[model samples]
Target: MNEPLAQRLRPKTLADVCGQQHLLAEGQVFRRTIESGRIPNMIFYGPSGTGKTTVARIIAENSGMTLHKLNGTSCGTGDIKAVLKDIGTLAGAGGILLYLDEIQYLNKKQQQSLLECIEDGSVTLIASTTENPYFYIYNALLSRCTVFEFKPLSAADVERGIRNALKKLSASEPQPVTMDEDACAYLAESAGGDLRKALGCLDFVVTAAPVDEGEKHVTLGMVQQVTRRTAMRYDRDGDDHYDIVSAYQKSMRGSDPNAALHYLARLLEAGDLPSACRRLMVCACEDVGLAYPQIIPIVKAAVDAANMVGLPEARLPLADAVILVATSPKSNSAHDAINAAIADVQAGRTGPIPRQLQNKHFDGEDAAVKGQNYKYAHDFENHWVEQQYLPDVLKDVKYYTFGDNRTEQAARAYWAKIKGEDKL
Candidate 1:
């Protein structure tokens, strides 16, 4: 039987892998580990088509261990125990490497089955997960494994893989198969850093395009016909979700309306309306802040409208919210001020509250407590009185740094006037 393009093109060795220079480069820990033939329990986490499975196979081959592969999505503890039993048959020989794919799918109770075997060194385990191992894998299982992160293939890497695939197809067929420059670029760029998807699109185009002059000529139209559209990698339960949202928030903070709108569109298209609005709300408070405090209510109302309308109509309100936030004068003073206060309290800087500031309206007011000396600001000039509001320990600390926007600058001037100073 003929193998699929992805399986047939799997890298036979570590050097054959395309990307992940951080891990596969010379003098790296992983290269050293493989060369030393000391295979440790590892968790390879990344997006699909990043060579996690291929890397695990290479390690097993280099280590000269009997390899047993299982899919965590389909296999259960019973399947694992069966593999362990088979490995026991070769106790005197070198141990086996159990390659578990999608190990994040294994539930907590299921993961516990490997604990004893892993601890006793009966079967060395290598697990791969598309989701973050730290969040999905059990803490105990993670503690036993050395986690290595993989990144998506670059456009250059995808192009290289496509050329290699074309070469293989030409070798097997009577006629040469070729792709035009435009077609190749389109395929590589539209794959979204996924080599498997790139190869799949290449296969589809090759099969659909008509053969001409003893060769199959692939064009931009053919590539578009096969691909239809490029997809954004935005899985709500995966790291891509967090990554895109981070980009969206950062774009708003950096005041790039174009980039911010692009990410917002991606989020809403992925049916993550709630997350999209929630991010806008965060940007309204954290980025615009006191520079445009009124924006908070507007953003909240926009988000509410988006949620109420949902989908087709939600994009309108979301777009409005994004523009309002991205174009507004940015300031983080309110956000930073709260964070500084929190840090101080967390670090044990909290002190007793001033007696006069305590609630005097509660039941019996005593002289030492609520009856303590307190100045009435209404009776003073300018409706302001000089008094210590912060705890004694934090009296010298200034948490709010004035921003460069007009509103904040005006507020800063007013505060200085009340404090009898020209500057904070």
Candidate 2:
């Protein structure tokens, strides 16, 4: 390019873009929008440096659309209308696209103005936000726009980007430069799913040493020294997705708090929100149990907070919840009991419903099955009518041995009596 390597390498066409195959496919929403010359107001929500602006530029270039960009921080409510005045109506010849970045930062009023503009079709609103739109954006404006999310560039995407960057740089800067596979991989990890960051790192690596007149590869040592970022072997989306979370669950099950938190952190870093939430819920019921049942609310609150405030910011709540879940008194009586019952059922352990608890409240025939043998527990002394509930296959099966923690000891003692254990 006539500019710096970063600028020269900036993708100008949709074909040059990567990681948004979902949007770029033939006759897709994005391509259709470009072909039709009119796009509904939409938001491109995603993480930093994932080429949101680049793709926006590509769309604008292809559609013959001029744009007025408002990064939510810089413009206010009035600025929006005033710009609308300048960009008036575009019915016939061309359309004006209003590009807003970090739209989550837009206050209620600014968002409202944009909403009105979209309703009038004055301009196609193409907004981008790093934050989750549900929590940050005003629902009204969000409803008006066709929201599209931009996913973080994968390691492979970033690697491809680095190679492209080197090609562009060599076209102008000459003096062959290369990033070895290991170094490229490290650069992708260090970039944290950000394409611009990966390009920035690659730019630094090759430029670190004097340009030899021949092809020279950037080494892992040079990358480590220059970027100070570690490469993760496991795929954020695939390789370790299930395995890491499973280990995390087992760690919590085994009463290892530190290991549990480590896994929680990994989930947050990997953008695995639902997995993180599910794990916290498990930890709450299993590890934290009734002991300091207060931990349950904390875990619930964190789960809500994670959904309310996602990644980068949401990481805090997840971290806090995992720690509390990890450190709280551990118990899995409930989980073990349920799981044991599942195993019994799966093993073809069917038994007639105990006449004492059979459902029989429907019709005359159903009623016959109900009171025929059922005994109300409330009528029994202390609401303690005990009877065998396990199927024949697990007639003698027991689960959930309580931990040594004080909160669990009393429960252990109580259940141990029912279990016929020698000690609590």
The best candidate in terms of TM-score: 1
Expressed as tens digits, the lDDT of each residue in 1-424 for candidate 2 is: 3345566688887778867778877778777777686667778887777778887777766766666778887888777876677654553237677778778778887788776657887678888887778878899888887778787778888878887887776766656676677877888777767777777667777778555558656889988886653333235444346678888887776767789877877776666788889877877887667666678877899889989977778888887877776666666666667787688678777677655555654446545543445556678765556676655555677765666668778776776575557452
Give me candidate 1's TM-score against the actual structure. Answer: 0.83
Against the true structure, what is each candidate's TM-score? 0.83, 0.60
Give stretches of model 2 more than 4 Å off: 1-5, 87-93, 213-217, 230-287, 290-424
lDDT of 1 by residue, 125-238 (tens): 999999989889999989998999999999998888898889988887677899899889888988888888888888777777788998988899889887655545667977
Q: How big is the positional error of residue 75 in model 2, measured in Å on the Cα after superposition?
A: 2.1
lDDT by candidate, in order shown: 0.87, 0.73
